[model samples]
Target: MRLSNTLLALGLTAVEATQFWHNTGTKSGWDAYTHEHKGTVDEVTDQVYKGSTALRMTQIHDSSYSGRYHSEAVKFNAYKKGDTGFYGFAFRLQDNWQFSPAQGYNLAQFITDFSDLNCGEDYMPSTMVWIDGDQLATRVKYGEVCPTDQQKIKSFDGLKKVTAGVWHRVEIQASWKSDNTGFFKLWYDGEKVVEAYNLPTNVGDGRPFQFRVGLYANAWHDHGYEGTQGTRQVWYDQIAAGDAFADAAPDKW
Candidate 1:
């Protein structure tokens, strides 16, 4: 669902502002959908968290293909430099997922294109959530979107224990601010794992960043599929963004 009038404004009391809700039951509702190499994003009915269907994101490691592995659904204009919003999604890993000696598997991110700066970086991401080993982690990227002294990223790891073959809820609420006046809070399965205030939630640029949720096997690109399982599967459902938690939460709305 693009930023449009038809987007869902969900809540006990709708905020009267533009919000988004996608059940992940279909492939045609998102602003954009993308995949790479042997990766695929499909709607599946066998495993679902909401409605009758959910999105299954799969990625196969191809040693011959040296590209980023991603199968994601994108929502544009999710936020900017000075906006505040809540984003939530429910995801489940494959029943046979390998956790020991685990590599990185990115689940969601807020990214924006910064090619206009030509700083050797293309689309730089601001906030990202992922699973590292058996723990869930997240990060915040700040500084100028271009070549600058302050361009840097800081990570927060060991948030919670991650399990496979089960539904897990993730909710992130942020007050986007370039200065040290913003706040970022993340909830994992209704447990508040990370909470920080007076921090830089994103870069100083004003470009509109998109919220994307899926299986992005970035470890394959950087660390070379360390796990024995070349084919990875993850299911996502009830992806949403809104002005408040109830509007974006899968169970609340």
Candidate 2:
């Protein structure tokens, strides 16, 4: 479908913030998940599933923070073959956080060499919908893997870069033009970053997998590395899931 037509059909607009669950750091809010550190780390607050609590991570032992936070309330439905939609998030990762496989899924993350001492060597799986491949963020190894036929499309290395330790917005839009004409695009901080046409596969098309928003930390699998002595934290706010409608349109039904 043409971008203009798709936008019209979706009526792209910002829905009421209240329609979403606010997970921040505050009192009397939803708690999707929370963990506290004992050593040098402290308490990490959770406002998961639209609460007023801030997700927190405290620093303690070897080259990293001790806690991690994630929300259980926000989840996405699996897409059919021709289904199309948009997804995005904004977050910040702390510096002290170690590069471990067990980081779980931080709303914000840091990517490093898998062989690095601090950087753990393991593929952290995310519940988030992504083109199937070995390298999670970039398409350095192969390309977009189509679930239906196991076909590979454009090189994923063209995808935008995600800067660590900073707050940025990464937005993705997937639409079906025809069985073979569908495409996907990503935007960073309102700037178009990556656009791919004629995707090898169609999402939401008879696939049994639904998109999920969560974190995956594989550090626990590393040898000689025990779980974080304390908790590491990343904060995610203003998360929404649904189809994108007309430009600047509110996301209300």
Candidate 3:
């Protein structure tokens, strides 16, 4: 919803995003959605952050299977080169979530397709927010999107504590620059955890990137699933994004 000058001052308004918001009560808000084999996406009322419903994303481990696990909702054109914005959401891990210090569980990411190149990763992700065990981690990807592009990945880990079974907030503000002039920052549970600046924040490929959230058991596909908790679930609510921090702040808007 674009807030008019009056609304911007009065803190009221209309439309979609200059502002965008989703209660995760239904599938109607996302630009695209997916749930791979054995993974399920549902709207339930058992737990919520702000509204009556929340999205439940679940993935089950397959010891004998070799496919990736993902149940996600995508917001297309979330950002591109030179665009600056704020994105935020509320999430909760299942009560019995098992944390493996050696493995990672990705929660959100910004990505774009580079199939036109055909020499490197097809769908390259620019920035990703995740948890390695109970600690928060994030990173930036830059350089040309090609086979010999250096694949520069600058990672920032051990940012914050991620607790299970309770609702937590996440907010990211980024300047989408493919050169060493961009900045990226993250806030966890209302606390500023990561502050980065003057760094290349994306690939040389200037394609529009999609913002995706939910459960992506990427480690299972790359490092193999860990422990016995084969089936894992996560809940998300109060998803939002826009040009200003308050427009996307989970608690503000």
- What's the TM-score of every candidate structure? 0.92, 0.49, 0.91
Which has the better lDDT: candidate 1, or candidate 3?
A: 1
lDDT string, candidate 2, 1-253, tens digits: 1123232233222343222222222322322222323322122443332344333433233445434232322232223345566555544445454444333333322121222223343222212322111112422111223331332334444244444455555555666333556676666567765677764433222422223233323242232244553444444444444555222111122
Query: In model 2, which regions exceed 4 Å deviation?
Result: 1-74, 98-155, 158-164, 176-179, 202-205, 218-231, 245-253
| Model 1 per-residue lDDT tens digits across residues 138-189 | 9888888767556877789999999999999999999888889988999999
Go through the candidates in order and give the clash count of each: 1, 50, 4
lDDT of 3: 0.81
Root-mean-square deviation of candidate 3? 4.3
Query: Candidate 2: how many backbone clashes?
Result: 50
Q: Which pairs of residues collide in candidate 1?
A: 1-30
The segments of candidate 1 whose C-alpha lies over 4 angstroms from its true place after superposition are 1-20
lDDT of 2: 0.36
> What TM-score would you give candidate 2 relative to the actual structure?
0.49
For model 2, how big is the CA root-mean-square deviation?
10.8
* Candidate 3: residue pairs that collide: 1-16, 1-17, 16-19, 17-20
